[model samples]
Target: MADFTGASTGGVSTIVTDHAALISACAAGEKQALKTLMKAEGGRMLGVARRMLRRSDLAEDAVQDALVLVWRRAHQFDASRGSAKGWLYTILRNRCLTMLRQEDREVATEADQIEATSQEAVLTAAFDGLETTTGLRQCLERLDGATRQAILSSYVLGHSHGEIAGRLDAPLGTIKARVRRGLLKLRECLS
Candidate 1:
């Protein structure tokens, strides 16, 4: 066995040396080589997946899928364009992104159903139960017209700062500043 550990200095680099040989061994149906590759790279791959998915179970799933892919498609890995480590990570990243896109679609479909409840309806229900509405109204009244409008567009109408800027014919920075200042004033008044 060639010294799999190369002279590179980093943690990943230490394990990633001679990836081509490991991948070739996998391609040649060497199960121990595949196991060696997994032993070396699994933790880092899981970390990458966890960062991307933000959930342990999802990260594990992605890493498992990526390993299965590495097993089946080991013969397809081309060493000319990039390192074998890069190829492995590309597969893992793609799997994570695909899972995320699927999750986003599921959430979007669910959100479509929930969107029938207007923000105003929700706010009205909340304010109806709270005695702080009077204080909030008074604080809002103290704001300058532009700042108040910015806050209202953001909090009441659910507009993004960019959208508020477009609607108010102001720069994005100005809109952000107005909203920040307005919130600070409201906070001071409420406290």
Candidate 2:
């Protein structure tokens, strides 16, 4: 229950206290100890969650879930093995990763599929509608096939340079260079 100020938190002085004792109090169903723990570490916890989750809303959700878990599992915390702060962050990180995994596993609905297909069709039509004899199309055709494909994948197909590199089985740097050099050549040809 002793409190002192310290600079351990990235130059920000926060009241230093025994997190283990706070957790113990929480384990004993002391609500005030939990509030004190949150007051001391909530911002840091949120920051950790935000970095892991990326999206603010998702980070908030993860932190909220972590805090709830901490409340429920306080009795299980073993201070001899690790610090309470480390325990808190582990929970937050696990929650964030779980959310990310769940998002990856989500099945796209029929509406989502149709929307994606329509968007892809629009981009494809725009690229295909370019007349073969037109100056732009001629310039694109003049480039090496790999370079032209790289530029088209990035600009018209809306793929990232990394994605284009993966698709072409080329290095990321090579894909980026192709797109840059192709654009420069096209500008010179157009001008």
What do the candidate models score in CA lDDT, each in turn?
Answer: 0.73, 0.71
Worst 10 residues of 2 by lDDT: 105-114
C-alpha TM-scores of all predictions = 0.49, 0.49
Model 2: lDDT of residue 106: 38
- Which candidate leads in lDDT? 1
* Residue 135, candidate 1: alpha-carbon lDDT: 90
Which tens-of-lDDT digit does each residue in 35-106 have in candidate 2? 777777777777656543445787788878987888899999999999888888787777776775565423
lDDT of 1 by residue, 1-191 (tens): 23345456755555345678889888999888777777778887887676546567878999999988998899999888789999998888888877765766566346435553454354344335346558977787788877876776454333568756876798999888889988999999989
Off by over 4 Å in 2: 1-14, 104-191
Model 1, residue 37: distance off in Å is 1.1
Pairing residues by index, what is the TM-score of model 2? 0.49
Clashing pairs in 2: none
For candidate 1, give the lDDT of residue 12.
58
